[model samples]
Target: MPELTQAQRNSLAILLDSREERIRAQMDAANVARTVSAGPEASDMADLAEQGAEERMDDAVVDHYRAELGDIAAARIRLARQTYGVCLDCGEPIPYPRLQAYPAAKRCTPCQRRHEHMHAGPDGRR
Candidate 1:
């Protein structure tokens, strides 16, 4: 199992906290925009159409952030378990630099490369 140094743990905690805050803010903004766009007489046709499109985009963005936050939360749990830097695919220790760059990553470079290669072909034929 891969174990993070105290400093690395602290760094990951900070990054996760920042990402959580950002996602929360975005979700809040999206909610407010959605509410404003949903009321009666809020229809200026052009404005309404644009707001609808923007709201849909915001929903998609929120979904993406939610998924990312889930990954971050899972990473945090793995950190607490002292398994934060181990590759899930190969059971190898993930590189420290890669961990710094992607704290939520679940695979080492080689395992990730092989996984990507295995899934690269169209229609999942590989």
Candidate 2:
């Protein structure tokens, strides 16, 4: 894999740092919400219902954010290893513009398209 240009590595590092901070904040908020939801005060019927709903929403949001964070962390590790923009599936250099747009992307468009095409059949059994 080609080493990231110094400028590219710098850019990716900044983005990864920002993403990590955002994910940490999100996880913190989720943890607080979870704690609140489980507290004895939440046992009141009205409080229980509201907390349940909020907990579900928080769960979904946290899951999404956590997955995105994992991707960003992986990309950051790749950057440190000088392989940040290489497509995992095709071994192609992912375009810089695409990386700028989605700094955590693991595959180039062609590889992603092929992957999606292969797995998008009915029943998703590919």
Candidate 3:
């Protein structure tokens, strides 16, 4: 396989930057959630409910960040294997614009659409 081009290298840099940002955000969210949970108990039912909701939201944000980090890690592995821009399903080169928009993409648009369609839930979401 050919080595990454300059544009691909730039995209990889973006992925690395994004990974750092996500890790920091995830850690911040986790720390805030921990601190809030360890603080004084809520004074009332409404306050307790509000605190619970906030904790759940924090957990969701952390989960999102973790998922994105996983994707970035996978992209890094592909880069190491010299297959970063190739569609995993079709073995075709993923477009540069798509990679620019989503550096961790593992499939070309058409293949991605098909994969999503095949895996989508009854409500049409993946």
- For TM-score, the strongest prediction is 3
Instruction: Provide the TM-score for each candidate, comma-separated.
Output: 0.71, 0.71, 0.76
Task: Please provide, for model 1 over 1-126, each residue's C-alpha lDDT reduced to its tens digit, 9 standing for 90 to 100.
Answer: 445678877887788788788888888888887788676654578887887787778777888888888989999899888888888987888877887787788898888888988888886544
Writing each residue's lDDT as its tens digit, candidate 3 over 12-112 gives 66767776686887688688768867689999999999989988887777787778778888888888777888999989888877877788888999999
Candidate 3, residue 97: the lDDT equals 74
Query: Residue 100 error for model 1, in Å?
Result: 2.0
- Each prediction's Cα RMSD? 4.1, 4.0, 3.1
Candidate 2 lDDT over 1-126, as tens digits, reads 454688887987787788779789979977986876575666578987897798788888888888898899799788878778999998899888888878899999999888888888698644
What TM-score does prediction 1 earn? Answer: 0.71
Model 3 has an lDDT value of 0.81
Judging by lDDT, tell me the better candidate of 1 and 2.
2
Q: Arrange candidates by TM-score, descending.
A: 3, 1, 2
What residue pairs are clashing in model 2? Answer: none
Global lDDT of each model? Answer: 0.81, 0.83, 0.81
